[model samples]
Target: MTEDSASMAITLSEQDKTTLRIAAYGSVTLLSAAGAAGGSPHKIATTGSIALGSATGLVGHVLAEYPKSKELNGRSVADIADRVLPALTAAMSLLKEQAPEEAENFRSTVITAIESATHHGQPGPVVADMIRKITKALDAA
Candidate 1:
């Protein structure tokens, strides 16, 4: 199969993946010290949720626009998960210097984002495994 075809073999849409990707980035940022310091922990968490939901909704709309194009179906859930974890870790590191509370909130947001992402396709176990692997490295740091 062609590379595009191979990637698109999965049922999930590119828009779905992209939404998750964007949510991952935004969620990671919310976990950053700058994000937490700029607002309350609850606020940061709630905003992150809203941002992720918006991205996911956009993904749904985008998927509807290209119902037959597998181009919009490319990418496995694992691939999307890979993008999320590293971004979160990096964001946390940069924000660590700001304060302990910020770091805690940042970590909290990352965890919540992972939880939300898991609620989509496949089982929660698969998503949890990816999150565990990524956090393993982060925890070591």
Candidate 2:
């Protein structure tokens, strides 16, 4: 957390933190899964996760803590999206309502992670589409 965020009056509940964590991390997971058929899913996941871990500010504080929530269980990509997409929207809504700067930080962090997950060159059609959905969800709030 930065000095600015630390000085803010914002106080998020545990569940809210969990939602943020899930929303951010699950995005990387989605990209990894989407690229599974064409390339190295593990590489995508690792690169994206590293990006998330590199986040800063209040969003960084929230993401640094491992979330204990079990709501991310999804046997398929569709199942995962069903949970993550809404979580992303919810997280943005919550943050924007309380701390608008943090909201932007979170958005940039996730977008950076998504871009890093591609690991060079342009993203494929499927990954690009998934990225669109993720961005849409984030902006939905």
Candidate 3:
């Protein structure tokens, strides 16, 4: 058999598998929220549920991945929040296109989350950049 035809298997540790799953689920969930945020009340409800579920999954994944490292877990959570903020700002912008007041609410919610995530210390350049981008988006929305 050719190399392409031969049976090929790859293995990952359980932790690695779980991490991959969590990342995939988180991305899909966030994308779905962004797509649905401009729709009706039912769609908003669905998006909210998915967002909460994804947050829970992330918490569990962080706990599993850094069971004995508080500092690591905190840093990981902050990094994740930073990464997610842009997508979230885009989603809020979509919501703004549909409902301006509700979009403002969403912006406030995001600002609160960002503040909570970064309140422990001064944000570095990366986190500050994310905050600036998010603020500009929210303001323009």
Error of 3 at 88 (Å): 4.4
Clash list (residue pairs), candidate 1 = 14-72, 31-106
User: How do the predictions measure up, each by TM-score?
Assistant: 0.38, 0.91, 0.37
lDDT of 1 by residue, 91-128 (tens): 44543543333444445544555455433333234334
Q: Model 1: which ten-residue window has the lowest total lDDT?
A: 63-72
Worst 10 residues of 2 by lDDT: 1-10
Cα displacement (angstroms), candidate 2, residue 103, comes to: 0.6
lDDT of 3 at 116: 48
At residue 8, what lDDT does model 1 achieve? 36
Cα lDDT tens digits, model 2, 1-141, are 656656255788888898998899989888988888768789898999899999887888788875554666689999989989999999999999888878999999999999899967678888889999999999999
Better of 1 and 3 by lDDT: 1
Top candidate when judged by TM-score against the true structure: 2
| Candidates' C-alpha lDDT | 0.41, 0.87, 0.40
Pick by TM-score: 1 or 3, better one:
1
